[model samples]
Target chain A: MIHRFLFHDINEGLIRHAKRYVLVVIVVVITCSMIDSMSAYFMDYFGEYWSPIEYGINEFYGRYPFVFDINSTDKFTIPFGWVLIYLFLAYMIGDYIYKDMNGYGMYMMIKSKKRWYWWISKCLWCVAVNVFYFGLLWISNIAYSWMKHGDIAFYQESDLRMSYYGFGFDNMGMPKLLLVVIVMPLLVGIVQSILQITLTLIFNSVATMTIIAGILMLSCYYGSIYIPHSYAMLIRYFSNESDPDFVAVDAGTGIAVLGIGIVAMVVMGYMIFRKKNVISNR
Target chain B: MKIELKNISKVIKKNNVLEDINYTFTGGCVYGLIGKNGCGKTMLMRLIAGLIYPTSGSVCINDKILGKDISFPDSIGILIENPEFLNDYTGFENLKLLAGLQKNVDEQEIKDTLTSVGLDYNDKRKFYKYSLGMRQRLGIAAAIMGKPEIILMDEPINAIDEDGVAIIRDLIRGLVDKNRIIIIACHDKEEMDYLADKKILMSSGKIVKEMIV
Candidate 1:
C-alpha cells in the first residue's frame, strides 16, 4: 500500500513535468562534476601547503581556543570535498522536490487533501534522493582520486592513519575523514528538508522558508562560536579522530544524531500540517 | 449523506471572510452557491472540505464533525477553486492518483470518469499542456470519480468553453438524478440555471438570498 502511494506521488510530480525535472538534474550533474574537478585540481596543487599541526597544537593549549581546528590537512580536505559534493546535490534535490518559486518568495504548490500521506511520501522521496546523491559523490570521489593520482587508493593510508590517531571520519565504520566528508553534509541536508517542510506548513510560503533558513544559519553560526566548553568537548569526543575504537564510538553518535534529527523534524512537520489551514494564498 | 454548517465564521488577518453562516444541505439535491468575487464561496467550500477551519461554529457531515471522524464522509468529493492538480501528471494519471485516495474505486471507474469529462485517457500528454477547459473537466472528473454522494465544486464552469460547459451540465445533472447531492459554487448563471435545483447567494461574507430554481 505504501509502495502504491509512493508510486503515485512520485509519478504524479515527475510525469507531468518530466522535462523540467530532467533539465534540472542535468544542470546539477554538470555543475557538480565541474566543481569537483576544479576542487580536485586545487587540492592536488595546494593541499600539502595547508597544515593544521600548528593550529591544532595552539587550540589544544587553549590559547587559540576553538573546539576544532578547520585546517588540519587530513581533517580539512577530505571533509571539505565531501561537504561540497553533498551540498551541491542537496541543492539540486531540493530544487526538484520543493515547489517554491525559483529563489523567489512564493510556494506555488499547496498541501490540500491527503496532507499526511503527501508529507510522508515527500519526506521519503527526499531521503531517497539525497542518499542516491551521496552515492554519486562516493563514486565520483573514487573516479576523481583515480584521475588525480592514477590510483584509486590515493588517500587510503592517510585515511587509516587519521583513524588510528583518533582524528577522522566516525560514521558507520567508514574512515573518519571520509565520514565527515559525506555524513556531515548529508545530515545537514536532511535537517534542511525537515526545516523547510515544517516552515512551509506553518507559514505556507516560500518567503517564510527563506526567513527560517536565515534565522537557522545565524543561530548555528553563533552557537558554534559561543558553545560552552563542556558541550564542545562532547562534540569533539564524538568527532572522528585518529583512534579506531573512538572513531567507531563517534560514528554511532553521529548516526544517533541523524536519526533523532530526522524523527523530530518529521513529527513536528506532520503535526503542523495536520492542524494547519489549507488557505489559498492567491 | 448530509452536510450542515452552523453559525460558521472565518477570520483571517482581522477580515471576516465568512460570517454567521448557517446552512444545511440534505441528501439528493443540487445546490448552486452564487457570490461575487471575495464573497466567501471558495472559503465555505474549503471549510466543508475540512481544508480550513472556521473561527466559530461547526461543520458536520452525516452527524459527525469533520476532523473527528476516522475518515471524511466516504461519500463526499470536492473541487475547490482553481482546480488545483499535480501538474506533472497527465490528466488520466492525475485522476488515477485521486481515485486511490478513496475506497473501492477501480481503474475502470477512473477511465469512465475521464471519458465522461471528455478527456482522452489513452493519451500520455501531461496536464500542463491541456487547455483550461480540459483542466476544469479533469478536476470535475476527479471529484466525481468515486461516485461520491455529495460533490462540492467551486466555479466548475469557469474557463471552459460552451461545449465543455455543456459536458459538465450533463454530468452534474446525471449525478443529481442518481440521488447524489451536488453543490456548485459558480458565477455563471447559465450553469447554475441548468444544474442547480436550488440556489444560494452571498455578499460581503453573509448569505443574502436563497432561491429554488
Candidate 2:
C-alpha cells in the first residue's frame, strides 16, 4: 500500500512538472546558448579546437579559492553559468512540498496512513526532479555539441583550462568528467532541495527559498572547503588539490558529505514533520 | 468505535484556539460542530482528525492514543477548510488519484461517490474550471468515498445550492450506520438541527452549549 501511494505521489509530481517542461526546455536552451557562445569566444581567441569536456569543465568550473587582501581591491565575481544552473534548479523544486501540504498534500498524508510514507515519498520526488533536471542539462549539452559539429569525448585542454580558470588539471578521465558534471551537481542539487523542504516546514516558503539562494551565493563569494556548496565547483578541486593551505575535497569526499547530508536532513525532517501540527497557513 | 478527546486545547501564536475541550464521540451518530468563523470548531475538527496535535490533550480512538499508538485514525477521511486539488486534473481523476493511496476502492466506487455528491461521474472538465459548488461537491465526495470509519467535513455546503444541499443532506443521512461516525462543521443552525443527532455549540474556543436534536 505504501508503495502504491508513493508511486502515485511521484507520478503526480512528475505530471505537475510536465506542465513546466516547456519552460524548463527554454531555460536549458538559453543556458546552452550561453555556454556554447562562451566556448566559441574562447576558441576563437585561443585558436584551438575545444572538446565537449571543455564546455562541461567551464560550466562546472567556478571561481578559484578567494583570498581576502586588505591592500588589494578585487571585486567578487560570480560564475554566471554555474550560479544560474544551481539557483534555477533550486527555485524550480523548492516550493512543491510546502504548497502541497496546504493543498492536496494534507489529504494524501491522511490517506497514506503514515507520516513517514508521505515524507519519504517527497524525498524521493525531490531526487527524481533533480535527476530529470540534471539529465536535461547533460542532454542539452550533447545536443548543442552535435549541432555545432564539435568533438564529443572525455578530453580537456589542460593548459587552456588551467590558464583560463586558474586551476591545475594534472589528468582528465571519463570518471573525473562524470564526477564533476553528473555526480557532484546532482548530489548537491538533491541535498540543497531536501534542505529547503526541511526548512520550509519551519519557515515560510519565501524565507526558506531565500535562505537556500543565500547559501549558494555565499558559496560562490567564499570558497571555504567547509561549505558544502564549494564541493560542487570543479575549480575548487583543481585549484586546491596541490595547495598546502587548503584540504582538497575530492569527488569521494563530496559524495560522502552530500550523501550524509541527504540522510541527516531526511531524518531531521521526518522527526519534525511527524509531530508537526499541519495547518493551512497558505 | 469511539473517539474521546480528553481535555483538548490548542494555542497558536500564544492565542488559545481550542481551550480545554473534553468530549467523547461514539459510533452510529452524526455530530454537528456548530460555531462561527474562529470559535474553534475547525480547530477541534483538526485535533480529532490528527491533523493537529493538542497542546495538552490526547485524542484516543478505540483505546489507541493519537501521536503514540497511531499517527492518525486507522480509517478516517477529512475535508478541512477549502478543497484543494491539482487544478489540471478532472474531478474524477482527482478522486482516482486519491483513491489510489489506500487502494481500498475501485473506479466504480469512485464514480458512485461522485454521483452521490451530485457531480457527474463522467465530467471531463478540469478541476480548475469547476465552479464553487462543483468544488464543494468534489471535496465532499473525497471525504466520503471509502466509507471511512470517521469522516470530517468543514463547511461542506458553503457554496452548494439549495437543491445540492438537499441532495447532500440526504446523502449524509443515508450514511449513518452502527459502526460509523460523521462530524460536520457548519454555520447553518437549521441544517444542523435537521442532520445532527447532537449539536455542539462552541464560542471563544470553548463548548458553550450542547443540545440534543
Candidate 3:
C-alpha cells in the first residue's frame, strides 16, 4: 500500500511540476539561436550541408585543445552560453522541492508519512524534466536540419569536423551517434540536476547556482575523463578521434561516471531531506 | 490514538519558537489551541505534523517516535498558516490533486467535503481567482477531506463570514468520531468555546492554561 502511495506521489510530482515548463521553453529558444549561429558558421566555412547529429555535437562541444596553465599569459575562454543552458536547466528544477515543501509538498509529505519518498519523487522529477528538456533540444535540432537538408541523416562530414572542431567522426555508426548526441547529454543533465537539487538543501538557490556554474566552467576548461561534464562534449570522445592536444574519454566510461553520480546525489539528497524541517517558504 | 510531546522545544535562528512543551493529545475530541500572535501555535502544530523537528525533544504518535521511527503521523491532514495550492487549478481540482496521493478519499468524498466547507465542487474558477473566504474554505476542506486520523488546521476560519463560520463549526462537529483527533488554533474565544471540547491557551511558547469547555 505504501509503495502504491509513493508511486502515485512520484507520478503526481512529475505531472504537476510540468507547469514550470515555461522555463524549458525559454532555454529551448536560447538553444535554437545557438544552433542557428553554429549552422550558419558551418554553412559559411565548410560550404556543406551538415546533419542534425553534427549540429548537436557542436553545441555540446566546449573549447577543444583545452589546456589550463596557471602561469600562461593566455586566458582560458569558458563557454558562458553553454554553461547557461545548464544553469537555466538547474534553475528550472531547483526551487521545485523547496517551494513545494513550504506549500503543497508539506501536505503531501505529511500524508505520505515517509520523507524519503519525497526525496525519491524529486529525484525522479529531475530525471524526467532533464529528459524532456534534452528531448526538445534534439527535436529542435532535427527540425532545423530537416528544413535545411532533405534527409534526417546521421552522416557526418569528417573533414569539416577535423578542420573546425579538431575532431573527426571515425566511421561513427548510428548507435555511437545516438549515444553521444542523445544519451550523453541526457545522462550529464540528470547528474548535474540531481547534484543541484541535493545542494539546495545546504545552500540557498543563488549559492547552489554558483556552485553549479563553477562545476560547468571547470568541466569546460578541463577535458579530464574524471570530470562528468566532459562526457557532454562530443569532441572529447576517444571514439570520435580528436587532435592529440585534447584529452579523450570513452563514452562507456562517461556513462558509468554519470550513472554513479546520479546514484550518489539521490542517496545524499535523501539523507539530508530525511531530517529537514519543512518551514514556510524557506 | 494518542500524540505525546515530551520536552518539545524548537529554536529557529536562536529564537525560541516552542519552549519545552510537554503535552498529550488523545483521540475522540476537538482541541482548540488558543494563543496570541507569534506565541508558537503554528509552530507547535508543525512539530506535531512532523513538518519540523523539535530542537530538544520529540513528538511521538501512537508509540512511534517522529523523526526516529516515522517521518510523520500514519494518517494526517493539515492547513498551516496561509493556505497554498496550485494557482491555476480550481478548488475541486486542487483537492483532487491531494486526494490522489493517499487514495483514501474517493471523488464523491472530496465533493462532499467541499460542500461541507461551503465550497461548490463544480466551481469553474481557478484558485488564484478565489476570494479570501473561498480560499479559507478550500483549505478547511482539504484538511478534513480524507477523515484522517489527525486533522491540523492553524486558522481554518480566517476570512470566513459568520454564516460560513457556523457551517464550518457544524461540519467540524459532525466530523468527530472515536477514532479521530482534531486540533484547531483559533484566536476567537467564543468560537473556541463553541467548538472545542478542550481549550489549551498558550503564551510565550508554553501552555499557560488548559480549560475544559
Candidate 4:
C-alpha cells in the first residue's frame, strides 16, 4: 500500500511539476538539431549543385557533413549551438525542483508523512522527462537521415564509413552512429539533469545553471573524460585514421564517467533535500 | 491528539523568528493564535506542520518528537502563508490530488467539502481563475477535507465576504472532536473570541496571554 502511494506521488510529480517542460524540451531539441542539419544540407547539396557535379571529382575535404554523421565538427560553429541543447536541458534540471519548491511544494510536503518520498518522486520525474526529451531528438535525427539520403539510409550510411565527414575524421557506420548520436546524448542529459539538480539544492538556481553550462562549454575545448560533457559530443571520440591531434577515450571510459557522476549526484541530492526546510522557498 | 512544545525557538538569518517558547494544546478544542504580523504565529504553525525546523527547541505530538519520530504530522491539513496550490488544475482536481495522499476521503466527501465552503462543486474553473475569496475558501476546504486529526490554518478567513466568514465560523465551530485538533491564526479578534475555546496571544514569538473561554 505504501509503495502504491509512493508511485502515485511519483506520477503526480510528473503530471504537475515536470509535464510543462515537454513543449520547451521538444522545441529546443528540434530547433537545435534542425539548425545544425539544415546548415550542412544547404552547404552539401546546394553549394555542390551551384559549383559542379562531375563524374570524377576529387573532394579535398567534406565541406559539410550530415548532422548525425558522428564526425561533423562543422556543426560546432556559431555559439556552439550543437551543444546548446544543454543550455535548456541543464536549466530544466536546475530550476524544476527549485521552482516547485518556491510554489506549492510546502503544501504537498505537509500532506505526505515522509519527506524523502517527495525527493524521490522529483528525481523519478526528472529521469522520465530526460529520457523522453532525448528520445524525441533521436527520432528527429533519424528522420533527417532518411530525408537526406535515399531509402534504407542505414545501408547508405555504410558508404560514409571510409570518407572524411568533417574535420578530416572518418565517419562511423550506422550502428556506431546510433550509439554515439542517440544513446550518448541520452546519458548526458540524465547525468546533467541529476548533477544540476544536486547543485541547485546546494547553491542557487542561477549559479548552478551557469556552472553546468560553463563546464560543458569548457569540455568542447578539452575533449577529455575529466570533462564529462566531452563524452556527450559523439564527434569528439571519432577521428580520422591519420589525424594527429585526435585523443580518443574508450567508450567504456566515457560511459563510466557519466554513470559514476550520476550516482554521486543522486546520493548527494537526497542528503541535501532531506535536510532542506520547505519554508516559502527562502 | 495533544501537541506539546518545548523551548521552541526558530532563528532565521540571525533573526529570531520564534523565541524560546513553550505551550501545549489538546484536542476537542479550537485554538485562536493571535499576534501581530511578525510575532512568530505563522512560524509556530509551520514548526507544528514540520515545514521548518526549530533552532533551539523541539515540537512533539502525543510525546513523539516532530523531526525524529515523525517527519511531519501523521495526518495534517495545512494552509500556511498564502495557501499555495497547483494553479493549472481546477479547484476540485487540486483537492482530489491532495486527498489521494491519505486515501481517507472519497469523491463524495471532496464534493461535500467544496460545497460546505460555498464553492461550486461542479465548477471547472482552474485555480488561477478564482478570486481571492474563493482561494481562501478552497484553502479551508483543503485543510478540513480529509478529516485529518490536526488542521493548522494561518489567516483562514482573509479576503472572505461577510456571509462566507459567518459560514466559516460555523464550520470551524462544528469540527471540534476528542481526537481532532484545530489551530488558527487570524487578525480578527472578534472572530477569535467567538470561535476559540482557548485563545493564545503572542508578541515577538513569546506567548503574552492564554485565555480559556
User: Each predicted complex: what DockQ?
Assistant: 0.33, 0.76, 0.59, 0.53
**Best candidate, lDDT:** 2
Q: For candidate 3, lDDT tens digit of each residue in B34-99?
A: 989999898899889888899899899999999999888988888876798778789998888778
What tens digits encode model 1's per-residue C-alpha lDDT throughout A1-282? 445545643554334343433433443345435444444544454442112211111111111112243655432112222223333433444433334211000111121234556567767766655565545444554544455456554333334324323343234244543344456545655665666656655554456555544543343233232222111122343533443333212444555666677888899887775655655333
Report fnat, model 1.
0.18
Where is model 2 more than 4 Å wrong at Cα? A2-12, A19-42, A45-47, A149-159, A166-168, A224-226, A239-244
Docking class of 3: medium
Per-residue error for B134 in candidate 3, Å, reads: 1.3
Q: Which candidate do you rate higher for TM-score, 1 or 3?
A: 3
Alpha-carbon runs more than 4 Å astray in model 4: A1-79, A143-152, A155-176, A223-226, A238-247
Model 3 root mean square deviation, Cα atoms = 3.3
What is the DockQ of the complex in model 2? 0.76
What's the true lDDT of residue B43 in model 3? 89
At residue A133, candidate 4 shows an lDDT of: 64
Q: What DockQ number belongs to candidate 1?
A: 0.33
Chain B global fold similarity (TM-score) for predicted model 4 against the true chain B: 0.97
lDDT of 4 by residue, B175-212 (tens): 88989999999998988988899999999889989999
Model 1: residues >4 Å from true position, as ranges?
A: A9-90, A93-114, A159-184, A204-249, B86-88, B177-179
For residues A172-281, write the lDDT of model 2, one tens digit per residue: 46678668766888898898889888998898878987898799888887766557787888767764553456655678788788889999999999998988887743
Cα lDDT for residue B158, candidate 4: 93
Between candidates 2 and 3, the TM-score winner = 2
Q: Against the true structure, whose TM-score is highest? A: 2
Calculate each model's fnat, 2 decimals.
Answer: 0.18, 0.91, 0.80, 0.68
Clashes of each: 18, 0, 0, 0
